[model samples]
Target chain A: MDVDTDVTSGGGTARPWPIVDINPEALAALESYKKRDPSKVVVRFKAVGNAPIMKQNFYKITASNRFQAVIQFLRKELGWKAGDPLVPHTPPRFASPQLVLNKPQFTYINLAFSPAPDDTVSNLFKSFCTDGHLIVNYSTTAAWG
Target chain B: MSQYGTTRGPPQAAKDRTTDYHTALFRRLSWEGTVPLEIRVDPNELPANSDRGLACYFVQAPRVSYLPLLMPEIRRFLMDVVFDEAASKSLKEEDWWFEIDDGTLLKWHWPIGLIYDNHTILTTIRPGPSLATTSTTPLRLILHLASPPTDKLLLAANAEACKQAFMGQLKEADFIRWGNTKRMTGLRKADQDGLWEGIKEHNFEEYWRVASKVTPTTTANRPQSPGPPPSSVSMHGRPPSADTSAPPERDGAYNVRSVPVRLYLPDGPVIQDLVPPLLEDGSPHTLAHFLNTHAPLLFPPQPPAPPPSRTNPNPRPPSHQELAYPLVQGILAPLDSEMAWLGACLAGADGWVNVCVGISRK
Candidate 1:
């Protein structure tokens, strides 16, 4: 039996891995978001000091897309392998502030502020952005007070 | 009153009651009297030997008129009591200029209060009484010669009058519409539109384009060698246009609201030029917008001109016409992120902004 696989030999019962008990409210919210146009919402990202340039700075994310989408996309773009920490414990000199593979801090309009990880892209953008486009500044630390 | 609950009032009685209410409302709503405008001047401008009674006279601003209509009255007051013979003669020729705190020179027609109102200068000054006592306070407005005043008497008189007038007015400005007043309430939708076509059409174009000398007196007096550097890379040294005040014409439209910006490219000569207006709603004037719209204009395709001849090895860098945009990809980085806002980038008194541009990889 593979350790990664969820299985019990004694009872022969199958267990679903990474189980989430779905709620109706959350399901309704997702369904509503699906009906609306996703392109209307755009998130604009800017590279910090000495950060590696992003191939595409402006990304159109659906209203339902979570903050995790951004982190995952960044990880994929940076070609970070699995088991690589999102928040690097050790300081790496070659590490670009733009591609900070650590507890990255993000600011909206003001440099000092950061949004919660659970915030939906559309909601966050609508609240914090200008001209229906949210400009997100990413840095390894809170850049300004 | 007792029978009113049981039965409706007669038609004639009801009509009389309504008429009475309307008359009372009309009386209250009618213009009562002229509002007293405060005429604050720089107390320092007042002559030390002048009558103490002159201070009291300034406090009584000519009422029921805006600055334009009231200017004649003020001029008369100045000519009669304050101005010397030469100063009085200059008034007739319209050789004088009015300067606001921000170095904005104005003519007689432009309303003085509007500048004070828009900039919130007086309010900022009034709060800190300690700052008021300082001797080296910058005078708000002065009526000096077109050239620096040679006559000591006239200069002293001008200073005295300006200070006296400024202080008097600041003491008690009438409850005038400074910001977001009743008129603004009517313009709620227009304000949201942000371009303010109404404000644009207020026929302020003439006044806004007040043609005085470009260089300040202080700067003009400075030694030639140590003078301000020439805006070498700027496409338009001085724009070709009738209106001296406006930035320049762009795409057949006059960009009246532009500020002079010096675009510093990496290891390249700085391109100093007026940036076009940020759209009314404060959207679309981003770094991307500048690159897309202006970069092409600033850096058009370089013509396949022959290489620099051996004799003239140092051919000048690409002029505005010769430069090309396709190879030019760069990110504009202001010192601070807020400088990204077009307004903040160049709202300085000098109307100049220094922007750093880094070449971007395709």
Candidate 2:
């Protein structure tokens, strides 16, 4: 495979740091320079399938915050509890009404895969942002494979 | 062997057999690995009259297993000693969370070994003469039964929620490696269930039977069935190869589209990058290449060469300086080890190479 040759070719050239060392204070300062003020990044939410759309699709979030903040924000906006079912429905006569919780809503980046809740917003925006905005896709059902 | 009908030449067949053996060995070792743990309940959460002797529970935890899986047994052993009857009755499985001695919240979704590797990076720092005691000491964790840190950790509500999260990670890894999640989502329901069942039951054969289907193989002898084009926008351009549908390989060197790598930096942040398996010229990407690209400041591009072999026959002396060490599967992986092989063999149950980088104090 000549893998050794390939390893050495990309070995020596040290590129300038694209992503700064993960210092919370330094990261916040660096992000502030990229945006207007207060270290916020623009996040655009898009509804998938029959999911309800938000009145304000674009929200400013702290760039250093983890992605879990976005999920919590969307859940609050949709009036859905953390573990609540995506669609509420009436109970059957034969079964307990409280036990019929449908699938929960899911969030994705680029409609490809679910980013971990711990993933930092700045990292996601740097890697997958489109048109200078981090596009977050939320769906009530399994929208994409 | 007979199924190939001599399509595979003798030497290639031998190489394939060797690779398969090593992969199986690695998986087996990973599955069987265990970490000695000294688990104790947070003293503040314990009842006033709790028995001090029974507060701590020691056990060897399976490295690949989730913390939630051991909750019932651990709670049973220490519940009476820690929580009063009323508190015990009110506590639920999701109410419990674990923390290291330093109070760092442990992510339930991460494998136990990965959690240990991430937190124990300081133990691996070379040239530190005083780290011997800490390195050999059993990992001490505090179990909290109240006020789980919801913001810092995802709520592992129940076993089902934990399984779903694991599946979500697997799909993420598959998508990162193939630029799509079709292979993971396309698995038959039974096979998909089997993958989780295997992990829950710790059955190596059952897990690999389905995992092998999703993981790309080095051999390019599979059928040329071009699946549907990727529906979502590809972050990286597709490799210049005609058979885009085929399981990842442009040649022997460039096998997988991208290696799903999550680097746990010593400081705190976890860096997940879309690292291709090979460099531009199709050479295997090594651990050094990955670190140089991602955390260049910690791991300089051209590390100081080891003192000349003739002068200092022992390349690794007592005072040798190592800027950083990348630990994969709880072992110090050589810098020259190829990412392709590590991703294939040492990836966590979620199918991502989780490298814990330990920066030296010096």
Candidate 3:
């Protein structure tokens, strides 16, 4: 279950599953990236993939809501308008509020994504697992700061 | 007569009563002046060099040694109790067992015996007696400060001094707290007369930490290289800070109290780099120096190979090339010009037959 959102979406893609449930903190973290490059976003989406994806019940990225549709969904979820802070001062680092898992061994996992990075920025971040590989539709990086 | 109780004044009456009660108490605990401390090595108490000395100060200079992991006040108390000129049997063998009431023990010091079966406890040597000669010992604990100490202080740097100081501290407090004296008292005794009233509670916590470091004189610290590669893959070698809780030992288990202590070691050309080599078999710095001096030497310069002369040629090949033409094929291998010397050798360049043994000498 998404920690931030109680809303549920169908397990697989309904074409770029609208970002109606994006986390507020995650939304706040992406403002600057949106302003800099609005067209193509190197975004991340997590679907219940404990099992593998098969073509029998196919899923793909993009629907009536294009990939950019997540941007507005994030804005409304986090209560933001354009010109909001690019990065929140404090990012949520924990998966749960209380450390319920105090075993001898306890660690955490997280989700992160970026808007389409320029060639220079793209080379620096090497993804390890799970890919939506950003589909860049907008290229206004010339004016990005 | 006594309720008017006898005619002795309260002050006189109090002194007389105390005198009668303590006449036999701590009979063995007397020192002309001050007493020296008890020092325990990791597992055993150190041999005492003097007959009537008190306080166990580290012999190594503060800059070159460790900061005393044992609290200084407890160390002083231990020396005062165990290093007494007369307390040889202050805390009789095993247990003399005293019952302490709760009141009127404004200040008192008694002998304590630690549970030697599961504990590392010992006493100081009187003169000719050595630590190896005794069966009692104590674990030495020193307070770890976040920042460094300002003035010169004894950090348990030397094995000999550290052991003695630790023993002395425990011995002193044993009488007043952990000793049988407190164990034998009635539970309802005045909260004030319990012998433990004289002990500094903060001081006891320090003793607990010290006692914890004494892990039954383990010989397990010897340095060893990584064993034959593990049967399964391991997630080691990753830099720390990535996971602060990662265990320090290769096997992921180590003594809780005895951790990776970062005490300053002696300075030397061989061990100058600040790497903490374990003091396992012997003096760690000394062992490092010896290894630096005697480890295996690397490939020696083949006497400059005397630059083989162009005029000299070899006698014969152990086997002729499968191909009829030997010279142009360059000894039957795909080696480039840079290895002409090898080609010359296989052409029996040095009068010896060359053969590729499939590179499987082992």
Tens digit of per-residue lDDT, candidate 3, span B282-322: 22222223222222111111122333456644423243211
- Candidate 3 regions exceeding 4 Å error are A1-89, A100-145, B1-290, B293-362
- Candidate 2 residues lying further than 4 Å off, grouped into runs, are A1-42, A55-62, A76-104, A126-133, A141-145, B1-11, B14-19, B48-50, B79-90, B122-134, B219-253, B303-320
DockQ of candidate 3 against the true complex: 0.01
Best by lDDT: 2
- Give the TM-score between model 2's chain B and the true chain B: 0.79
Q: Judged by TM-score relative to the true structure, which candidate is superior, 1 or 2?
A: 2
Which 10-residue window in model 1 chain A sums to the lowest lDDT?
A: A4-13
Q: What DockQ do you compute for every candidate structure?
A: 0.01, 0.12, 0.01
* Candidate 1 off by > 4 Å: A1-145, B1-64, B90-93, B101-113, B121-140, B144-362
Per-candidate TM-score, chain A: 0.50, 0.57, 0.18
TM match of model 1 to true structure:
0.20
Estimate, for each residue in B167-263, the C-alpha lDDT of model 1 and write its tens digit: 2121111001011122222333433123122122322222112200110111011111222212211222323432233222221111222333444
Question: Which tens-of-lDDT digit does each residue in A44-111 have in candidate 1?
Answer: 77656544455566777675565556655654544443235565673332344434455343333323
